[model samples]
Target: MPAFQSTFDALIQSWKLRLQDAEAHETKLPARMETCIRVCEESLLELRQWVMEHSFPCRECEIYFFKQVKPVIKARYIYYQKIHRLHTGYFNGSGLLEKERLEKELRELAQYFTDNDQFFSYYRNGYTHHDELFFVRGQYDWKICPEVNHFDDLFSTSFDGKLAELMAYELLMKYVDGMLNPSCKLTEPATVTPSRSVAVSRLQCTASVTDIVELGYALHAKGFFNDGKASIRDVMTFLSTMLQKDLHYYSRLFFQIQERKSNVTKYLDELKAGLTRYIDQLDEQDQLK
Candidate 1:
């Protein structure tokens, strides 16, 4: 196991502790939600602290051990995936503009890490066998000096470190909601009753209400809702209000929801494509720098 293995292990252990505690005592929704938030927050803090403390060695060592040898890159990749999920989750529930913004950031971050990882790969041989004659000779080779090319500067700078606790917390909440709903894994309930009128023996917008309720059930079936316990009445009421304000809202919401439930391979391909572009950009920058 590598150094990062231990760091991730520690993180997992801490999470397990939180999870255990939460499961044991958090029987209510409020308590469960709080515990889930805490679990996410504490894990994020632990990772942030670890990166700040061990950023140097991880970067330096990984250059030689390319092909995902070090923990830092793997760590970043893992966090990136988590963050992407959160972003997607949020996007699924948000307005179009918000979803677009998150998608942009997701792509940019993916590209940034990909570029950095490729940059490290360039000096892999020299860094890997530092004691070898060829490696030593390469060290003083000014033409390829990393410092002159700002490799050190670029490498030392952690772009992803800019991730904020507030942002992470929001994203994690979205993820937690998705996880608990279980709708993501199973079909939504077949029928959910809407509130019926008890007075005047009259109903209002019954067809519209029924349609909205059906849509909610469909969305829930598609694993759109974050809260599993959110009653049909709750979903129907929320949708009724929103739809009354804007009939086109569901169309937008459904698009994002579909994206959240998009094929996993789609995301994997995006990451791969971003990294490939990053390598090309790194090569261009190397020449310019």
Candidate 2:
């Protein structure tokens, strides 16, 4: 009876230790984490404008889905990957790991990435293939809430799609900032582009989906379903107003748009530069005010 009691006590202690480790492993999200969150919020701001403009019974879903969603999703993946690597490194570095450790590593990785596929892959499908998962139902005053099984709720603590996207933003801030804690400022980030001229050149060369989608949505929202304007500059200007709304999203989406171009690196550089400049201007205005 004494031996059994001791074994039970050890098992409880082990379980408690594992739980503590899992919770402790998260660390307190870092400063760059906030940067990531800001980007996510900006994306949603653009998204909300697009949604409010388009609303329902309209054709175009969004302008930048293929262009932007992947990058935003991938940024989250990078954060999760960092966490996975951190946990794995901690276990390996601890030197007490054993043959039984494979299960623990596998379980921890699963918790972060889930089944060896990157978390972004799930988001890529979720954001773009939303129709495959949700539909408008009911007989009257029908709503556009996600289906009961849409994986989006996994990203949500607030249950609003906008809020879920925002959660991803906060998660990003916490994740990256966790890496940059104990140091207050992470003032410099690697820009997607280095020159303003390059950005404007590309901005002239290719059209942003934001412009087109906003035009479409504005038409939908205003009951003006056929005001056809294919001007990229117009979209860019609309995107500008949105940038005025969210700098982080504007910059990320700008990169995503560039990613879609044939000369992706060049375009990305320009777009990156353009957003960096745009955000700087806004930051300056805020400082002055």
Candidate 3:
């Protein structure tokens, strides 16, 4: 039991650190979510494999694994999966229609909690009268189990899956709420001067807004301007003015970049190759001279 607990603690700590790193990096939302989901899957698999290979010395330890440990790990997986679905499926842009869709999803998630209020209350209030039946193998009560399908009699109990869903839904609600009502102050568009307007008019962005947004994010990540103090919105606003393009939805476009399965930094890679070729031409001319 002590060894198992210690190993589980270490696994969770490692998983958390990886998640933090993924979040801290300037990756796309879907990419970060993929990393988070992978980490959770790996951790859960490790725990499941260990439990299957070993027998618990007593019922108390078995209950601890199911009621406390396994459900928490499974909850994390469920949470990330649901979040990934939302970002990939529901979210489009910050337009009225998108906001409406997100709000509707949020309400649906809330309704799930309302539907399962009894189990939620039981779990949240720390009532453990049914721990033996809920956490122990071969003690499942079909009448009370929220899930009827995909039962794993060897490793899962009737209520643990429900518990995991409850926890995951709680986290999902908070995330969806934050999406609908972000706390960050909106950045207004930069005021354009007459001279700046003329210059912007003279120069046009031939590339797609998606490409420009990719470049803007790269520059922001590299701290190319204002000693890295500039927010992404600021950089985007400047790029929009310079290119005479509306980049108000750069964040949404960036999310699209994240969803790409291959060549996520397509534009950035192209830029690098193009610059190298230009330099090579200049070097060849200098050698000829």
Candidate 4:
């Protein structure tokens, strides 16, 4: 699981870096959007191929992948596609006309939410009573399932795509609101204390981010921090700042770790072996002395 997750995280990170670079260098909005759309399509294709080749270890892992992991990636694809369509029709000179169009689209999005209020509430509230039917493969309930043009029983669930759609709509709403009121967009505050800066500079992680993420999760699972009072998010944030690596998608990566076929604690096992070997070396030195 760690191997596959590390590969997947690397793939996502590479594309995200490319997208960031494109945004920085490309002045044209359409060209940048094209790059984003192409990258998303490529990612989805690779994910589909992986799904086709691998069998999940169990139903729960499958549910987590489809419900939590896959939707995130799919939501990005849907967002870019929708944004591309919206921008292609954007009116540059007529502010009033564009505002009207955006408002109409907003209303439509609201209507979609109203239509799926029950499922949206279920998702928003973190209810998992219907996970088996909504996320598991081939558990589609026709009476409740949304209309999908193309359904792949092997790779898709009844509600995963809809879940992606809901997430995409959220992004769209924020974007459209930004367009409507540019000042409403929030910006991250740039402030760093000198003491904190010194602390971060002194600490460094030589291992890969995936390795660090694995270690962070293990620590969290074992209640190593603050006697289990610390949340995973808190732990990952502390590690990220200390190690100078972004662990934004640690949960998705951890999901992949959970789905490992064998040796699920690969990193933890390696850590134990390395510590034991170091102790053995110390004993040999003592014998030499």
Candidate 5:
């Protein structure tokens, strides 16, 4: 689940009751949504502190291994934080432009992670809106599971047997598995050079905006996920840099993937056609000016 908290106390209690009365779960209430988060947070804090204090490593009979894996573990912490934040936002509000803005961020983040949509920005979007509804195309175990006989029964049942799990959840779980096992594969990241050469030779002005963005994503996704440097200082640096930058040029050249049609590839096509027509008409008007 792309949920911020791994398990809420209410969620856990719900699971317990689900095992007790699977059908009556709709009526089974939780203390509060935050209960689970608070529990998860305290548990994780203890666990991380233990790891840090004892330096426990899953592999290698040495504490040195924990040092190497510390980054990965820390990432899970951040992932949980993001999940909680979005979970709160959904119940509360993320402001007016947050959804669209975060959607764009997630799509771009997907490029870096190369379709690892679970931790991607849009994953946050889903958590913050529509009660964090995620849409999945396939029956991936982690992303989509259907509620069936019982939540407890799922451990014994094959993934195919469950229908209550959301498809998005299953897929997102697959992404998480990829993070863990890395047999978990994602697409390669890509980029658009914004040069005329590729436009003329490859895309031929007919390439769709989705195609261009996909290409860029494919290029960029090949790289590793960069969850570092996102602290307050880094955020301040980014904002300061952004304030000095040109949004119009960047928006036209890059940052408009949400619409798919605002990509430079689309702009080039319209501009080319319009310029050709304008030049032709201007030549006819040469009779006057």
Candidate 6:
């Protein structure tokens, strides 16, 4: 029981971290999503193993499954739904009209989770409380059921573990795509021209913590960060404003600058110079104010 409790705690922690990463707009969310689902699957499998090893009674095992495993899976599905809504709201008025098609795609992706939620509720209610003899009407006897069955067999088939796995995988893929590239318009061809273009590839480049700090410092110098210390939220807000305003125009120039510099140090130097010049101008304006 102690070991099972520990595993369940770890699973909850993993889910929390996964959602935290999503909230922070971390580039590695897809990876974290995989880890999150893997932890749930593993813990559930471990519970099954323990039940078999101890030869626990069917009712006890079912109670354990209901109390422990179901919560993790249910939470994951809810997280997916929340993220989908966040994506939709975040990009709703991004001014990239072409991205409306992608918005439609996102809605479709969200529907998948809605469907899964319905399926989960139906099976969970029946399997958890009723013990295979559901009160609900007229559902065909599940082919996997027998005249009588153990909790393990009932859960193994009715829980539909494979379906859950596939749903998680699909949700992760679409969620990652939507989160990381919300500004993207899939209907248009990706721009190859280096002149003042926002390449789809550039959207994939995530800002590291260090990058955020440096950018924040520059903005602070330009009088954007009123406090001496820049918080993560401030950095994110500045970046979002930049994307919505100036970056859209100069993104191609930035990309061209990156392409021209082969040496890492030179690249950093040139990038810093460009940012510094812009920051100085903003500082001058602030001083005049």
Q: 1-289, model 3: which lDDT tens digit per residue?
A: 7865675787778878887897899378778888888888888788878878888878878888888898888898889888787777865556232777776776677567667767777897898888888888888666777762247877788788888888887777767656754443334658999998787678756999889999999998998867777767677777887678887545546666776899999999999999999999999999999
The C-alpha stretches of model 1 lying farther than 4 A from their native spots are 48-55, 60-289
Q: What are the RMSDs of all candidates, in order?
A: 20.8, 21.8, 20.8, 17.2, 20.3, 19.5
What is the C-alpha local distance difference test score of each model? 0.43, 0.39, 0.78, 0.76, 0.35, 0.47
Best by lDDT: 3
Cα lDDT tens digits for candidate 1, 1-289: 3664554666666676776787688776445655665666656566546545654354343332222222233333344355444444554443322545554544444344343443333333324343232121123344533332222222222212222211233343333333433232233434534443243235344444324544675655654655565533345445665445333223223333344555523434555788999999999999999
Report the Cα lDDT for candidate 1: 0.43
> What's the TM-score of each model vs. the native?
0.28, 0.24, 0.60, 0.59, 0.25, 0.32
Q: Is candidate 1 or candidate 4 better by lDDT?
A: 4
User: Which stretch of 10 consecutive residues in model 4 shows the poorest summed lDDT?
Assistant: 180-189
Misplaced by over 4 Å in model 2 are 1-29, 56-106, 111-131, 134-289
Candidate 5: stretches off by over 4 Å: 1-33, 48-76, 87-98, 104-263, 266-289
Summing lDDT over every window of 10 consecutive residues in candidate 2, give the lowest-scoring window: 133-142
lDDT for each residue of candidate 2 in 144-233, tens digit (9 for 90 to 100)? 332322333222211133323333444544433233222332223345565854764564313454443333334434534124432222
Q: What clash pairs does model 4 have?
A: none
Of models 4 and 5, which has the larger lDDT?
4
- For candidate 6, list the clashing residue pairs, or say none: 197-252
Look at candidate 3 and tell me the lDDT of residue 11.
Answer: 77
Residue 204 of model 4, lDDT score: 67
Worst 10 residues of 1 by lDDT: 157-166
Clashes of each: 0, 14, 0, 0, 35, 1
